[model samples]
Target: MQFETCHIPGLVIVTPKVFSDSRGFFFEAYNRKPFEEAGITANFVQDNQSQSSYGVIRGLHFQRNPFAQSKLVRVLQGTILDVGVDIREGSPTFGQHFSIELSAENKKQLFLPAGFAHGFSVLSETAIVAYKCDNYYSKESEGGIRYDDPELAIDWKIDPAKAIVSGKDLELPLLSESFANFTY
Candidate 1:
């Protein structure tokens, strides 16, 4: 397995060793010992999965301090443009974002530390995304930046006009106006 850190501190992209045979392929998606050796020692406590169709933009969300989660996310059955933003106040890369293409074919995983906000857009006909979280979720701590915030200007790839978003997400406050709850 190879672990590559992104431009932002604490964010990493992991590539696993895959073996293929006549029938199929296999890889160890997660192994604690190797992860710890790579300097990632988060005790992931929860697992979450979601499935969405083409052009669906799920989030640019995070939880405040006590409930903030570090996530290891991967695509299970299709393709997506996964994005993470450094929202840690006062950090050198504050407000800077990174994106990567994750798909079943490539089998890549992204590790997003607690201080970042995350989201993904489906690029295939449909996609299944799964992730591990280091902390439990808290409703009161739940927060988000609008996926289309002008200042952030995230490109979902699909036409924004044709993108499908939940009413809640559509109404999420722009980065400028939301999440004073996050800490440095």
Candidate 2:
């Protein structure tokens, strides 16, 4: 596997070396030793999966300290534009964001360390997204920034009129309002 760090410290992009033949293909999606050698040492504790159709957007989400999570995310069935934002206060890149195309064809994965916010936009007719997390979910600690915040200016690659979002996501605060207690 190959790992490349993003602009944010601790955030990474993982590309697996796939072995393909006329029959099919195989690759080590996760190997502890290689990951550790690549400088990723998070102890994944839970796995989660979700399916969404094109135009669906979910994210800019994170948990507060004591329940913050580090996530390794990938696509299983279709494609999506995965995004991660640096919400860690005091960091040089705070408020900055990174995005990548993840698809079953590419077999690429993204590591979003704690202190970051994550979300994605489904680009295919349907998409199955999977992820591993170092911490469990905590409802009380859940937080997020509005997906359309002008300060962040994320291009979700989908028309705003066609975008579908949950009521919870719609209720999220803007970046300025949400960063009051942020810390690295």
Candidate 3:
């Protein structure tokens, strides 16, 4: 596996070395030693999966400190535009966001440390997205930023007129009104 650092601190793009033959292909999805050596030390304790169709957008979500989570996300069956926004109070890239295309074909993953808000937009007919979290979820600790927050100005790749978002996510606060207790 190879870990590539993003311009934003604590964000990593992990590419696995896949071996393929006429029969099929294989790769180690997760290995503690190599990950730790790469400076990605999260001890994942929970796994979550979701399915969405093209035009569906979920996120800009995070858990408050004490319940904050570090996540490693990937697409198992299709394609998506995965995004992460830095919300750490004192970080140089605070309020900035990064995005990448993850698909079953590429076999890549995104590792987001605890201080960022995360989300994704399905780009395929249907997508199966899964992620590992270092901490369990807590409803009381739930927090998020509006996916269309003008300040952040994320390009979801999907046309806004056709984008499908849940009422809950649509109600999230804009970046200016959002708060993050985590600091760099």
Candidate 4:
């Protein structure tokens, strides 16, 4: 596997070296030793999966303080435009985001360290997204930035009219308001 650091200090993109044949393919999605050697040693405690249809948008979300989570995410069935935003206050890239295409075909994964917000837009008829998190979910700590917050200006690659969002996501605060207590 090859790991590339993003603009943020601890965020990374991982590309697994796949071995393919006429029959199929294989790759080590996760190897603790190499990941630890690469400086990602988060002790994952939970695994989650979700499926969404095209035009569905799911974030710009994170957990606050003691419940913040670091995640390793990938696509299992289709494609998605995944995004991670640096919410860590005082960081040079705070409020900035990294976007990438993740698909079953590419077999690529993204590493979002704690102190960031994550979200994705499904690009296929249906997409299966899976992720490993260093911390368990905490409802009380859940927080998010509005997906269409002008200050952030994220291009979700879909028409606003066609985009589908949850009521919670639609009610999220803007980046400025959400960052009041953020720390790097």
Candidate 5:
């Protein structure tokens, strides 16, 4: 496997070595040693999965400290435009965002450290997104920024009129209006 860090510190892209033939393909999805070598030492405690159709947007979400989660997300089927936004105060890339395409064909994965808000837009007819999180979810600690916040100016690649966002996500405050307490 090859682990590459993005411009934002602690965000990594993991590409597994796949051995494929006419039959199928095989690769190690997770291994403790290689991950530790790559500087990712989070002890994943929960796994979550979701399915969404084209135009569906889920997230721009994060948890406050003590309940902050580090996530390793991948597309199990179909494709999605994955996004991670840094909210860590005092960090060089704070408020900056990163976007990537994850698909079953490419088998790429993203590791988003704590202090980052995450979300994805489905690009295919349907997509299965799965992730491993280092911390358990806390409803009270849940917080997020609007997916279409202009200051961040994320291009979700889906038409605004076509976006299928949840009511709660639609109600999420914009970064400028947020009271998040993330730190560097």
Candidate 6:
């Protein structure tokens, strides 16, 4: 496995070496040793998966400090425009976001540390995304920033007219009004 850091600290892009034969291909998605060597020591405690149709946008969400989670996300099928935003207070990159295309073919993954908010938009007909989180989820600790926050100005790479977002997500606060629970 190879780990590449993004402009935002603690955010990493991971590429796994794949072996292919006449029948199929194989790669290790997560291995403790290599991850620790790469400076990602997240002890994942929960696994989550979701499936969405094209244009479906999921989030810009995070949990408060006590329930904060670091995640490793990858696509199991189809493709998506995955996004991560830096929200850690006092960090130089706070409010900036990073976007990447993840697909079954590319076999790439994004690792987002606890201080970031995460979201994705489906770019294919359908997509199945899976992720590992370092901490368990807490409903009371949940918080989010609006995906379309003008301050963040994230280009979800989808037509706004056709974008599908949940009412809950649409009601999330903007970056400036979001809950402050992280510090650099």
Candidate scoring better on lDDT of 3 and 4:
3
Per-residue alpha-carbon lDDT of candidate 2 for residues 41-120, written as tens digits (9 for 90 to 100) = 99999999999999999988999888899999999999999999999888899999999999999999999989989999
Clashes of 4: 0
Question: In model 5, which regions exceed 4 Å deviation?
Answer: none
Off by over 4 Å in 4: none
Candidate 3 segments whose C-alpha is farther than 4 A from its true place:
none
lDDT of each: 0.91, 0.93, 0.95, 0.92, 0.94, 0.96
Tens digit of lDDT per residue, candidate 4, span 1-184? 8999976788899999999999999999998988998999999999999999999999989998788899999999999999999998888999998899999999999999888899999999999999999999999899999999998899999899999999989999999888535676
lDDT of 1 at 92: 91
Q: How far is candidate 2 from the true structure (C-alpha RMSD, Å)?
A: 1.1
Predictions: Cα RMSD each: 1.1, 1.1, 0.6, 1.0, 0.7, 0.5
> Is candidate 2 or 4 superior in lDDT?
2
**lDDT ranking, best first:** 6, 3, 5, 2, 4, 1
Error of 3 at 131 (Å): 0.3
Residue 101 in candidate 2, Cα distance off native in Å: 0.5
lDDT of 1 by residue, 1-184 (tens): 9999988888999999999999899999999999999999999999999999999999888998789999999999999999998888888988888999999999999999888999999999999999999999899999888898888878888887779999988888887787645555
Once fitted onto the true fold, the runs of candidate 2 whose alpha carbons sit more than 4 angstroms away are 179-182
Which 10-residue window in model 2 sums to the lowest lDDT?
Answer: 175-184
Report the CA-based lDDT of candidate 2 relative to the real structure. 0.93
Give the TM-score comparing model 6 with the true structure, all chains together: 0.99
lDDT of 5 by residue, 27-127 (tens): 99888899999999999999999999999999899999789999999989999999999998888998899999999989999999999999999999999
* Cα-lDDT of candidate 4: 0.92
